[model samples]
Target: MSQTAPIRVGRIGYLNVLPIYHPIEAGEVAGPLSVVSGPPAELNRLARAGELDVTACSSIEYAMAAKDYLLLPRLAIGSRGHVKSVLLLSRHPVARLDGKAVRVSFQTHTSVALLRLFLERRVGIAPRYESGDVTRALQGGERPDAFLAIGDEALRLADHPDYPHRWDLGSVWLDWTGLPFIFGVWIARRQAAVAAPQAVAEAARALVAAKDWSAGRPEVVARLAAGQGGFSEQAMRAYFEGLVFDFGPREQEGLAVFFAMLAEAGHIETAPRLEFLDI
Candidate 1:
């Protein structure tokens, strides 16, 4: 809404995020907008810096947003079960993950945090951190018993015969708590909402619209996926079909559970209430 410049929107550059970002791709000509894409953490930083009007970032980031952010409606990156993107790959058995040094693929704070909370509470393990490649993480380096990898990297290793040690974080959360896990959501700065509710709504609507477009054209959607984002025609179609994109009552329930889990684990000082934007 800043009349001085065109609105700059940031979107996550991951396959799991394609549906939310498809609108930006579709609107290159008519939407008349400037959009940038990057990892969720980077996008969150830009949003905090006022460099982006809106972005799809880790749901936790939005929860812990720096005093001036708003959650948008009817859009999110979440899964009720078997979220192929978020996985825990282990060299040791799942029950014996205690006192283990595990590497978490960077750019996966929300998943890592959630996983850690689960591990500490359920598995009773305090994992040490080793940051690096997903393949290397499985090698169990100096002290790695397991590694947490999310997004495309996790999907690639889902069914490797050599390491039959894959755990879908979403499914795990659901089994344990009977609630869906919300990985990501869209957010806008408070100023942007006040100054340009319409713009915020437009961006949110664009994301929601992209879901429909992406749903109908699996082949085209797969073609748009490129360059090691763990996206193939088969994978894209499965994800689109299996995963739900709309932020409805179910997603809200998921968000509430996420906050509750975070709170129970002492990861958050306070669990903030969420308000969905009508855009």
Candidate 2:
């Protein structure tokens, strides 16, 4: 616990965030920042615990800890429609699964919340759910009635023919609200933002610049995503292109819609008031 360390930054170490981290990944970019990478859930926990000064976090985690964090403007992992990852694969028709058990990935919070909202609102049936490694559960000879997989794993499981009913949560959200679905965002600890305003702003600059730099080189991200997960290069290309990294008005509206639904369904106490870094 180095109190005097330069802003401790965190990011999800997965292909989904390549556009934002590509410059850093290329070993061509350096700054007065301590970068710590982990899975989404781990990063979220580290951010909430104040171990990370700034982190790429699940929107659900941001919503839950809104008072302690300030969103870094103009960056996110969201999709307008047909996100190739973030899947809900069911053994039975989704609408008919009333009391069946489902396994959800332990690494995602936003996706799990969205899964519940979609199940109750769209399918009108609330199935029992447990969090675990979906692949491990299946490989261990335990077949849950249904399973939710997100990120790279979802993209891989989608090609399986046994799971006939595959639902892309992002596409469902688009269909439900005609807006983009935001899964993750970069948030700064409020105290860190106030005490190290320049550092926070500088980090924002680096990240936004990294995003711009990667935006110009989609081939780099496509190749990385495709090769890492054994996913089709064409599919990865489309996936990378389909994602919207901006935290503009339209993206905010989509988040508002999602929070409202989560609140109405009692998944959360209320929708959080979004706060951004003063920079």
Candidate 3:
């Protein structure tokens, strides 16, 4: 990587991350970054393909490929209780959905894994899963018993009349484990960190500063994101209030527990060690 080249950073193209990215995009926090926008699944693919130097990737994605990445400390997309987004909307009760087909959004990885952990492990039901665009399918009058929705789409479909039984996955996880659910974490490729430590550090500091700046101006952030999700400013504010962006000790504990559970359930080979970039 040339020293003059901007760091290629992956940004999840969702309203949930606007508070952090909005500032950077608006030039409130300056850094030598070339932002690549996509959904979590796409970003995860980019990270795996060695395209993204730094990204806010799915937490489970990082766990699956821990050897290739180092987490940026003190930054995450999590929820202590009800996330409002990242939902499982069903036509029937969750307990009775065994053997039913559940269409999962192609835009997720961590939410899919988390949903499986909830249904297969906690509820003791195995639902047939398939990938499709839930929003488009629903608009076309196709219903597959249940569907997983995340980010802005989830927010839009939160009160859809067609799906009366809705389960907020984050809330469900917290209720089951008594810990916050980390949906996404900022990370850098180990190779990138080693080759351009200064660039990585600059990106990390810019992200933290953006988060801090947004934290003090919730109303402004809400207004900026409200239009994207078709939500009122107040609703966006409440949604932001429900989210946890800091990766502190409690969040780390929750992530550890999630990894342990995934390993025990054979989703992953083993719980990878939590490694962080020393920025």
Candidate 4:
């Protein structure tokens, strides 16, 4: 596929990203693109450094880089309510831990931002925040009073009896804004689109097509994703159920609300204008 040589794409390593990544990674969808897998944070940095031409990045990353990149149209990882994958795990209820420190995962930045917004704006609890050591957290090492965990680990933590108090970040956002919460958006650097417009366009089409592919046969995607993400097939199917893979008017409204909240919280000077690659 020399026609589109040197097209680099970043795939998020988490299970939630699999519905979109599976086609590209498995060679089912043909593109003259190379795929690299990493957590959302890592992929965000790589895309910023220009190592990746296109990727599904944390929603916050897209906002921060909006001027430098154009979002790929009609693709996102969002949830309406009760997203089991993004959770606040605490030994005690969140309201009761006012003076305690809240540890957070370093994987996805969107959930971190959402958690902060929820705690401060809706819940009215201001706690000290620190990055949780994911490896240590999983192994029962030094523990904090509360921590934000996203992706697969959060899903597992939801059912664990030890963490009695848990809050779904997506549900919290929905309660606060009366809108679905978007965690990640597909994006491509402006230079990549300028240099290889057709490649970039084709890649977007393939990604949107991937969503349709998954919707038509979720069980196939589920079994394949279960193998890739090392989760039970049932669990994978359940996870897919909560994720919104398409971008429509409702999802757009959610993004606007999130951007507004970020601006309101002094995260950005001005909310970014949403731009998409021409399809």
Candidate 5:
């Protein structure tokens, strides 16, 4: 690659990723880099198309694309315990979701599939899925008994006190596997990490630094979250404090359990061995 080649970085447009990209946007960190933001699905597409050198992708996409990618070290979109942003909103209780109608977000298939497995294998309920937004599906139509929501939308649901019943998937995953749930992880082209080790290290440093800075400063979080995801001060604070970024050994147990569960449920044909690219 030429020196002029922009190091394309793919990321999701959500509050969960604010720390990873906020510094780049704020000019606190800089180098030969470019940021591309979208939903998890779009990021996966970009990474698969060779349009991105590095991307924070959904766990399912990472497993599917494992043959050609490597995980970025010490970085991820993780939750130590409960993450309110990944949720299941229901008009009825979760126990009543068996064979119930549910609207699913196509943008977040991995989490949805995992939830399905939990309810089936763990909770012993198998629900039917439909394609539609939560609000639209419940608008006097075949209302979704429950809706699997993620990212900024799920955060909004967390703030909805009147929503009555909801389940934080992260909490459920942790409860079952006794580990944190990592929703997104940074992945790079298999060749890129080998050929451009310095660049990869630089990128990892940038992300870690950005994460540290954002964690300590609520001001930065508030500014970025407000404009990027319409996240309020309270919500931003919760996001910054609740989500963990390090993808080190301490979190590997959780990640391993997650991969195993996905494979067992047939969402992933085989569990991909995770290796954090040592920068």
Candidate 6:
């Protein structure tokens, strides 16, 4: 890429991240940035392929490919508890779903891993896992015993009458470990950071500025995000309020615990050291 070329940044196509991306999209934070939007899994793939210079991707993806990326400090998508978005909807109790078919969303990697840890380690039930279109299945009135949903889909299906039992993965993890759950984090590709240090730093600063701008105006952010996921303004406000956008000490500690558990459970080969960009 040319030195003058714009930095290609990946944005997660979920309302949860609107506060960060909306400002950048609206030119509130100025930088030579070209934004690409996609689901979490797609963003992870692009980041792994070196297609995106900077991106907010699944937390697990960062660990799996930590050598290729440097974390952007003070930015993450996490929850102290009750993340309302990442949910496990089931017809039966989670502990009783052994051997039953539970459809998992293909749009997720971290949530699926977390769900596995929850069921096998915490709930003590191993359900048959299959990858499928959970939203389509639910819309078509084809209810499997259970299904995992994340992002806007989870928010939409959170109160659906068909599934009486809903488990918030964030809350479940918090209860199990007494730590926050970091779903996603902003990262810069190592090559990008090394090749265009100033560009990467500018992009990182723009992201922090955007977050700061959104911090003082939750109602405005909520209003902007309303209807993007069929959620009311009030609901969006509450959802945004529940999310933690800072990658502080507590969030890092929580992420460390999660990575350790993922390694212990064989979901990952090994726990990775969190590598952050100096800028």
Per-candidate TM-score against the hidden true structure: 0.89, 0.94, 0.98, 0.95, 0.91, 0.98
Q: On residues 1-279, what C-alpha lDDT tens digit does candidate 1 reach at each position?
A: 554445677877777777656656667323424789898889878888888887778888877863677777777778888788888877778777776777786776689788887788867777777677767645664435677877777777777655568788888888887877889888878888778777677766666777767767667666666444635677677765657677788788888877877877888877778866666
Worst 10 residues of 6 by lDDT: 223-232
Give the runs in model 6 whose Cα sits over 4 Å from its true position: none
Model 3, stretches more than 4 Å misplaced?
Answer: none
| lDDT by residue for model 4 (91-166), tens | 8988987878888887878988888888887889888888867547658765568888888777666766667898
lDDT of 5: 0.78
Ranking 2 against 3 by lDDT, winner: 3
User: Model 4: residues >4 Å from true position, as ranges?
Assistant: 1-3, 138-140
By summed lDDT, the worst window of 10 consecutive residues in model 4 runs over: 1-10
TM-score of model number 4: 0.95
lDDT score, residue 67, model 2?
Answer: 87
**Per-model RMSD to reference:** 2.6, 1.8, 0.9, 1.8, 2.2, 1.0
Top lDDT model: 3
- RMSD of candidate 2 to true structure, Å: 1.8
Candidate 2 Cα outliers beyond 4 Å, as residue runs: 1-4
Count of clashing pairs, candidate 4? 0
Choose 2 or 5, whichever is better by TM-score.
2
lDDT at residue 68 of model 5 (Cα atoms): 87
Per-residue lDDT of candidate 3, residues 1-279 (tens digit):
865578999999999999999999999999888999999989999998999999999999988999999999989999999999899999999998999999998888889999999999999999999999988988898877999999988998889998899999999999999999999999999999889888888888889899999999999999988877778999999999999999999999999999999999999999998999997
Worst 10 residues of 2 by lDDT: 24-33
Write model 5 residue lDDT over 1-279, tens digit each, in one string.
Answer: 543566778878887787778787788877567889889988888888888888889877888879989888778877877887888888888888888877788887668877887788888988898766765544545545678888877876664544567888888887877788788788888777766777766776787787777767777677667776766777677666778787877577777777787788877889889866776
Cα lDDT listed for each candidate: 0.74, 0.84, 0.93, 0.83, 0.78, 0.91
